[model samples]
Target: MDSVSPWLVILGMAVVTVSTRLIGYWVLGRYQLSSRTQSILEAVPASVLTAIIAPMVLATGLAETLAAIATLLIAWRLPTVVAIVCGVVVVVLMRNVF
Candidate 1:
């Protein structure tokens, strides 16, 4: 079998990642996007966030459920850092005190 260094494999993967992204941007830039397409693109980030969080929220216990809800509400109304800190505080207090 042929041998290759781990660093070389990492470098190759990074090159592939950058190349695919450049190709995708090159292709996408050629199009005149419709209003509907723009709207869909704007919603993609929120949809992806929900997809990632929904499963964790659903599988959590009471403290986690409350923490997640508090995080979401805080994040919606306040800064992301505040929301994250609040969530962590809630979880730590709940786990340690009760």
Candidate 2:
């Protein structure tokens, strides 16, 4: 048994990531996707977002949940900087007062 340096582990992961992406591009370029497949691919972003956020809302405390909602609301329509500042404010106030 041998211990590997952390840099080697990180380099290995980078290589794997790049290799897979290149392979995916090479393979996918050979095919033409139908409308149905394109539609499914378009839906993937929303589904992935839900998959990521569903558990965060379910598993966290009320303050965190409220913060997430606040963040989303401001982020949905406002500038990114405004949303971030307002979200931080909302979370801070919620945590302090709740």
Candidate 3:
């Protein structure tokens, strides 16, 4: 079996990552996007976030999901760093005791 050196692996990953970003930027810059396309692009971040969070929330069930929702609300209404800390604390406490 062949094993890759750690540096080689890291170098390969960096190359691939940069290439992907350059390709995306090149493609996007070449196009004159429609207003509808721009609107859709605006939703991309939220959609990607939802795609990531949805499955984890569903698998954890109602209590955890509710805790996360509350955390996000608190995070939104308060200072971002403080809100994140509070959310982490809540989730950890819930998991340990419940």
Candidate 4:
């Protein structure tokens, strides 16, 4: 069997993502969402981010776990980009020291 190209895979993924977003917007436009539902939808991004990162933090080594803790603390009070940069720095430093 011929192998699929990486560019093709990326293009397919992009198309799917855009199509899903557009379709969702179109569908949601037809409905009147309740305030509770709208609030829940607004929280989706943070929930998705936590779902993605929680497992990595819990399952990884001491360095990653420690870095995650530091990142969370920073994230509570700082801007997201700063927290991310600080997380990277902490992880790199922890990896070297531990």
Candidate 2 TM-score, true structure as reference: 0.69
Q: Give the winner by lDDT: 1 or 4.
A: 4
Best by lDDT: 4
Clashing pairs in 1: none
Model 3 alpha-carbon miss at residue 97, Å: 1.4
Task: List model 2 lDDT by residue over 1-98, tens digit each.
Answer: 17998899999999999998799668866789889877887898899898997876657667768888888898899998998898778878887877
Model 4's TM-score against the true structure: 0.69
Candidate 1 or 4, higher TM-score?
A: 1
lDDT at 8, model 3? 94
Model 2 error, position 32 (Å): 1.4
Stretches of candidate 4 off by over 4 Å are 1-14, 77-82
List TM-scores for all candidates, in order.
0.72, 0.69, 0.75, 0.69
lDDT of 1 at 38: 84
Candidate 3 per-residue lDDT over residues 1-98, each given as its tens digit: 17879899899999999999899779888999999989999999999898998876767766577668877898777988887788777777777776
Q: Determine which window of 10 residues in candidate 2 has minimal summed lDDT.
A: 55-64
Ten contiguous residues with the weakest lDDT in model 1: 55-64
Q: lDDT (CA) for every model shown? A: 0.85, 0.83, 0.82, 0.92
* Model 3: per-residue Cα lDDT at residue 42: 93
At residue 13, give the lDDT of candidate 1: 100
Indicate the worst ten consecutive residues by lDDT in candidate 4: 1-10
